[model samples]
Target: MSRRRRKSLPAEPVRCVIERLSHDGRGIAHQNGKTQFVDGALPGETVMAKVVGSRSKFDELRTLEVLEPVAERVTPPCEFADLCGGCSLQHMAGDAQIAFKEKTLREHFAHFGGIEPEHWEPPMRSPDLGYRRKARLGVRFVPKRDSVLVGFREKRNSFLTDIDRCVVMDPRIGDRITDLRAMLYTLQAHDSIAQVEVACGDDAAALVFRNMEPLGSADYERLVAFGKAHDLHIYLQPKGPDTVHRIWPEQGEERLSYRLDDFDLTLKFHPMDFTQVNAGINHKMVALAVEWLDVQPGERVLDLFCGLGNFTLPLARRAGQVVGVEGDDAMVVRGRENARLNDLDNVSFHGANLQGDFTGESWAREGFDKILIDPPRSGAEEVCEYLTAFGARRIVYVSCNPATLARDAGVLVAKGYRLVRAGVMDMFPHTTHVESIALFERK
Candidate 1:
């Protein structure tokens, strides 16, 4: 059988007026009943957009020229904002971005769950720029250019965005992009470097280089020297995540930690462990969830999908006991370690497949009156099935994906919980991703 040839997009830029915004931060335009998702075009804006990709139902486009500008549109701060995929909504004003996210959250709730929150909490915003603390940057050396490319991928393209500096990333790594590229270009294994994983704490920042092959002694020495000069921790991963090992300063400590000043607690984790990308937003988010859950002194709280005890340790300070359940045994150990470090005897960490039937587990049998969930983008639909059994009077859900959150909210409502308050968090500002929290009480 012969394969069908893909259709080519028109060459000339087409004029259109953006009708609204798509969930992914694209401008939605209708032309002859076919929708167009135009990048860099805000809602209510008239622009000439060039077609990039097309299909029978919808089309993809990029703004070539804006004939009319919208009130919310602003000059993007980053120079490479047009080419880099680091942030999609940088052109939209900060306040407008938050409003769009709030609108998206409400639409998700109404469309998916057929329910709305009784109250909408004011959005928690990050007050500063360059707040990102974690990222995985792609690294590649192009022989044709005889230079290295170090940054995020191009917008809507698989090719790496050849960017020198990033305004959204933390200064620790963002400011060093050009320097890193120069250093990598001088290394013998420059082409072998796959990517660099970045993680930062209040006092320290670390870079983990993923190498496809073994590095020469001179290259290894250079990487270590670079780390020493910058006062940054250096790690190397020759194969899988488990192969990540530190090389700089022969390190006294293998982990990085951030402090929750409000709670006077510090949590530590390995450089490769799961952590929030934005430290400031994370601190505020934990406090917000704790406040909404309303944990009493003698209450037992359950924190599902708890990683490294971010929320568990904090909640343990107020609740009589807090049980943190996670699927990864390594994180469970980390959670226990953090609890011990904090000297919180009331909190315990357990390892269990949250998607499976784990109510028979010893930790689940304890019965929690208050609950908190901070699941990944997949959300916690499977665990919602067992929430009613836990008999928790109040549940606080911190979600990264609004669609999944709305779906799980429906399940919670069906299980006798009413969504009382919900709001969006500017955890990842300038991006389309929405981090929201919802409070559900037993009806």
Candidate 2:
């Protein structure tokens, strides 16, 4: 059987006035009965867009030229923002980006949850740029260019963007992209190096190089020298997660920590462990959660999906007893380690699959006065079903995806909870990723 070829796109740029922004930040316009999703075009602006993709219902186009610009549009902070996939909304102003995210969350709440908060909390924001603390940079030695590239992939394509710096990432790593490329190009195992994973703490940063093959002595020494000169920690992964081991600063523990000054707690984590990418926003989010929970003395609190005790430890400081339950056994161990490091004996961390019924377990038997949940993108539908069983009066939920959060909100509302206040957070700026927090009180 012969495969059908995709229909060709129009070569001439079509003039269209963008009607509005899509959920993912693309501009939507309608020509005749077919819809057009144009990149790099804003609402209320006219642009000439060329079709890059086509479908029976809608067309995909890239802005060829802007005939009229909107006030919300601005020069992107990063030079490569238009090409790199790392940031999608860089052309939009900072305040406008937050407004778009808030609008996105509101729509999600209305569509999926079928309810709205009694009060819309003001958005919790951080620095609009230069705040990313964790990233996995794509590395490749392009044979055609005979050069090594280190940065994010190009928008709508898998090819790595030839960017020298990333303005959105923390300066320690973003500003050194060119330097990283130069160093890797000089190494014998340049082609063998697949990617680099970066994780940063308050005082230090670490880079984990994923090497597809073994590195020679000369290449290894060069890596160490680079680490020493730049005052950065170096790690190498030969095969898998277990093969990741540190090489530089042959001394202290293989751990980096960020301090929560408000709670007087220091949390340590491994380079590969899951940590929040925005440090400042995390600090504010945690504090806000603790305050909203109103953990009175002698009250028992339950923290679900706790990782490294980011919220659990702080809640532990306020409540008499706090139980942190996580799906990952590794994170449970990491949480316990942080508890000991902070000298807090009031908290206990346990490992359990949150997607199933763990209600009969000992952790669930203790009724909680207050609860905090920070689930992943899937949100906490299964857990929300049994939240009433815990006898918690107030619940604070931190969510990375607004759609799932809204979907889970319906389950919670049916279980007799009112969404008192909800708001967006600038956890990831210059991108369409929406992070939100909500407070629930027993209705």
Which pairs of residues collide in candidate 1? none
| Model 1 worst lDDT window (10 residues) | 124-133
How large is the C-alpha RMSD of every model relative to the true structure? 1.1, 1.0
Q: Assess every candidate by TM-score.
A: 0.98, 0.98
| Cα lDDT for residue 25, candidate 1 | 93
Model 1, 3-122: lDDT tens per residue? 998887899999989999999899999998899999999988999999999989999999999999988999998988887898899999999999999999999999994789999999
Error of model 2, residue 340, in angstroms: 0.4
Give the distance in Å from residue 22's predicted Cα in candidate 2 to where it truly belongs.
Answer: 0.8
Error of 1 at 372 (Å): 0.6
Residue 6 lDDT, candidate 2, scale 0-100: 75
Q: Residue by residue across 1-443, what tens digits does model 2's lDDT show?
A: 99998787788999989999998888999997999998888999999999888889999888878899999999988888877999889989989999999999999999974689999989889897779999999999988899999999888889899999888888888889889999999999999999999999998899999999999999999999988988889999999998999999789989989999999999999999999999999999999999989999899999999998999999998999999999999899999999999999999999998998888888778789999999999899999998999889999999999999999988999999999989999999999999999999998
